[model samples]
Target: MAGPALLLIALLLATLGQAPTARAEPNVHIYAAASLGDALDAAIARYEASHAVNIVPVYAASSTAARQIANGAPAELYFSANERWMTWLGEQGITLSERSDLLHNQLVLIAPRKDDASSVALDKPGELVARLGAGRRLAVGDPAHVPAGIYARQALQSLDEWQTLETRLARADNVRAALALVERGEAPLGIVYKTDARASNRVSELATFPAASHDPINYPLALVGTSPSDAASAFREWLAGEQALAIFQDFGFAAATSDAH
Candidate 1:
């Protein structure tokens, strides 16, 4: 699979109009993966209105976010699209206690609605690969570095379709980018998170990888070492509260933790 060209765009509101050397707000510094941009914004708004303080969120890939935190990026909270990165932080002793799996997502195939008559179908699992027998383009995140892509690749392997479709694959730097390719009709179909597929009307879901196809897709959230101990605990509690869980469900994510006492 060939990688897409770079097109860096700022998606975070707080990071906009601020240079790297500019003054930063004294609010909680949150380093989140890019995929969470939509969900985090909704969560932050409710949190600030109720809590009376700002929480700055910096969005990037989960791996990139982890690297920044490891290099002292001044992040008080770390929310990753996958748990592996958070597990890495735990290994480095940067995770505070009371870690929680915040959400669960599935990998799915999306295509332009106009292409609906084609071989892609949500109920049929290997149909896309069967249809793209030779060289139709298929977009996906770069499995080498991106967690979503990793899962996408793992799922394809489970279906025994990776090798057959390898030549026609167009790899993007992240899930959003891959979605962009399909939305633009650059590729007939793309592999992206189920939430992302639902987020856009330009594309329709073609198929979903079975939950048993790959490892569990767990999104874990934890307080980083830079946050105040008290505030960190408070934030974690609020995140799992009724308000936050509702927001998560609205954004098409399944709550990973049970509130049952």
Candidate 2:
């Protein structure tokens, strides 16, 4: 899909002035990709403690979140795990010129922590399917809409494993759901973000997908439409500030996007 021609505004809170205080504290509603939950939640807590506003976060597959925003959801900002959905929002004219790529993540293969299976190096062409045996399954997000699933599919195809594993997949709505499938042993293995795997004690990393296998994982945040809320705008800037950057590292995300700073 093509994006609308619009100014990509840069939000600098110090120069922008404080948001007008509402009758009651206004909740800053954010629609985001599910994979952002841990880091974003920590940052929200800190922001709420120092500021009088509360952040309301709705996390789902990036594709799902983008569609929800386009359907008139009351989200003030959108955080997507991949640029495709954010660009989709741009096409809908729902995202303002003020946007920043907030963070980065890596695709990984994980399995139940207690499993006896040896780590399968993804560089080998047929290692993945051979480990699954005749009927065992691998779990992943629904590739039709989930960013993690799309990356997983790309990695598998690059390794020449997709033809063997595609039909055998146990697909889930989002990456975390796919992780749960592996955690519960419903599927012997699963594909998820490196951050997701780190957040879970129930799973262990088996392999990391080479960067060549898929597009870079980027988390982009943008003000939805012409957001007038000072609170929403302030919070958006805070996410890229030092405090949030520390929190992002704690939760397994890389440094903030270079371009946004």
Candidate 3:
């Protein structure tokens, strides 16, 4: 009985001597536009497989993400769908590091996969309205703030269809939401990035908007704060590298050319 009691005491002492395991904190936090969701996820997974660092990403409209960063969100890096929001961050004195356009996308009109319309002539006035039929609305990101919505507005305006379609829009929080509306058949049609349309099998693209109709759809990436973590900087650099660009291209995004706006 004395030997058994001594053995139990020794086990208890050994347990107390062992330290508790510490939880690993994320080394980098990325705030990216909603449209980059799938591609960015793939890129992160591939990068993490080779590198020893923890990365966490937040996806939202560029406008919403920029506001969050401006309001003290813990974003080590920002990837915007357009230059406007990134410029806004700069105006706020956010101090972006290594800023450059990383990718380019195209605006396209899409509809539910069940819709038989293969292509629509966007240059013709009243054609979109005819396709919308009666009482149904066209889905689009909220033109008030979303970059995709803004581009959609520009394209419509350029095509001389804005007045007719402005009141017929089913506004959404972001481009992905607009795409979801078309995919779910909540709206008969939607305007979204080509990449967004490609991501969903439920939606079929109707037409690609002319590049001259709107501002170039550029995705700019930057280190958010003045002193970004070394891991964050490395990740930013890798994103512009060939490996990451290939992943983005596979997802239907084009590498941003120097001349791209």
Best model number under lDDT: 3
Q: Which residue runs does candidate 1 get wrong by more than 4 Å?
A: 1-26, 115-126, 226-229, 258-261
Which pairs of residues clash in candidate 2, taking residues 3 or more apart in a chain or in different chains?
8-97, 9-97, 9-98, 19-230
Candidate that scores best on TM-score: 3
Q: Please provide, for model 3 over 33-122, each residue's C-alpha lDDT reduced to its tens digit, 9 standing for 90 to 100.
A: 999999999999999999888889999999999999999999999999989999999899898878889899999999999645678888
Model 1 lowest lDDT segment of ten = 1-10
TM per candidate comes to 0.82, 0.88, 0.89
- Ranking of all candidate structures by their lDDT, best first: 3, 2, 1
| lDDT scores of the candidates, listed in order | 0.78, 0.87, 0.92
lDDT of 1 at 69: 88
lDDT of 2 by residue, 1-261 (tens): 123323223334533556665578888899999998988999999889999998999999999999998999999999899888888887886756578787999999888997574688787767787766688889999988899999999988888888888999999999989999999988888999999999999998988999889988989888887744999989988887888999999999997555541
lDDT score, residue 28, model 1?
A: 78
**Candidate 2 versus the native: TM-score?**
0.88
Q: How much is the lDDT of residue 158 in candidate 2?
A: 86
Better of 1 and 3 by TM-score: 3
| Candidates in descending TM-score order | 3, 2, 1
lDDT of 1 by residue, 1-261 (tens): 123322233334445766477553347777887778898889989888877457789988788888888887888888888788888877776755566787888889888766444435534556767655456788988887788888988888888788867677888877888999989988888999999898888998877888988788878777877435565567777987888989978989887864221
Off by over 4 Å in 2: 1-23, 115-117
